[model samples]
Target: MQSLIQQYFPNVLLLKQEFINSTIETLYMVFWTAIIAGILGTLLGVILVATGPEGILKNSVLYNILEKIINICRSIPFIIMLALIQPITRFLTGTTIGTTAALVPLVIGVIPFFARQIENALLEVDPGVIEAAESMGTSPLGIIFRVYLVEGLPSIIRVSSVTIINLIGLTAMAGAIGAGGLGNLAITRGYNRFQTDVTIVATLIILVLVFASQFISNTLIKKTSH
Candidate 1:
């Protein structure tokens, strides 16, 4: 296998192992980060909507605090957040480098991003449906689950697709800190070494992944939506 690659694609063959490892690392980082972020973000977003001025459980104090916290966190740049949260990341993952360490910042950085997306998606649900549910004596929790989440499913899918694509880009930046992935491979072995072919290949792979994600998400949205 190695011999054949080397014979046919000598330039990339030398970094074939690194390519595979980096791809796996990126997938690992993105997958775990997305899971954690998706859960937290969904919860937080639902809370934001449910506690807003017109929400089922509106509370000025709680809504203000949560909104401010999300806004503050989202305001920080991802790269800066990566550097700013080094100590916390180290505490969580026991190191400030590698895929594991990168997960901390990735999850933290993406939570607010996806939270806002989820919030918007939920907001897009027709207010009349929610009112009708309430008029029928549906519990707050039931309305949230059946009305907001269910009605917002397609929009949520769309936003989730956007978030995942953004996450792919963030994973690339994570490579700057030695979080081994295609981004790191491109920078360290491709850019640093002036290997144009390597850089192009890494970029193309990322693009393919992004496109595939979009396609799947769009398909799901079309199937679920009216």
Candidate 2:
């Protein structure tokens, strides 16, 4: 067993601790980014939904403004966004490197993505359900929380799963700026070092993470569906 590992997966054995640490860093970045962005994105999405021309709180100006902001952010490619936002990242994290600093770009990059997903998800809620709630004299806030959100839960989970998968991929790119994750290992230690084993191992682990996240999300969606 040991011989086979050393032969087929030498780098895995050689950099055992690195693989573990990088995986942890990757998870750390993903978890925190998702939480922070999830809240902000969901809020923006809800507001966009509530204030749209057809929304309960109907405000074309607010909706168009918010929509334009989200679209602008989404238009910028992630890599440039990383370099472009270096000043802000440094100001916020006091450095433009490492897992913590990486969160700045990661969150900013993902908010628009997640917000759009959330908006689409919430939009899937039937207009009649909203009307029924309004007829009952429910406040817009109450209708949003109880009717739109509840009905949209399954779709929200589905979109959230896709967003998280995208976030995982983004974390790898974050490594280009020294964010310290499997991507860092893959690039610096694997590709740069000319060690195919490290690169392969890093990719395999990232795939596992993506698949696991999708599985968990599917499960939640199933349970949440009415």
Query: Top model by lDDT, which number?
Result: 2
User: TM-score winner among the candidates?
Assistant: 2
| Prediction-by-prediction clash tally | 0, 0
| Candidates' C-alpha lDDT | 0.93, 0.95
Worst 10 residues of 2 by lDDT: 5-14
Cα lDDT tens digits for candidate 2, 1-226: 8898799888779899999999999999999999999999999999999998779999999999999999999999999999999999999989999999999999999999999999999999999999989999999999989998899999999999999999999999999779999999999999998999999999999999999999999999989998
Residue 226 lDDT, candidate 2, scale 0-100 = 82
**Model 1 per-residue lDDT tens digits across residues 49-152:** 99999899999899899899999999999999999999998898799999999999999999999999999999999999999999999999999999999999
Candidate 1: where is the Cα deviation over 4 Å? 1-9
Judge candidate 2 against the unseen true structure and give its global Cα lDDT, from 0 to 1: 0.95
Question: How far off is residue 103 in model 2, in Å?
Answer: 0.4
How high a TM-score does candidate 1 get? Answer: 0.95
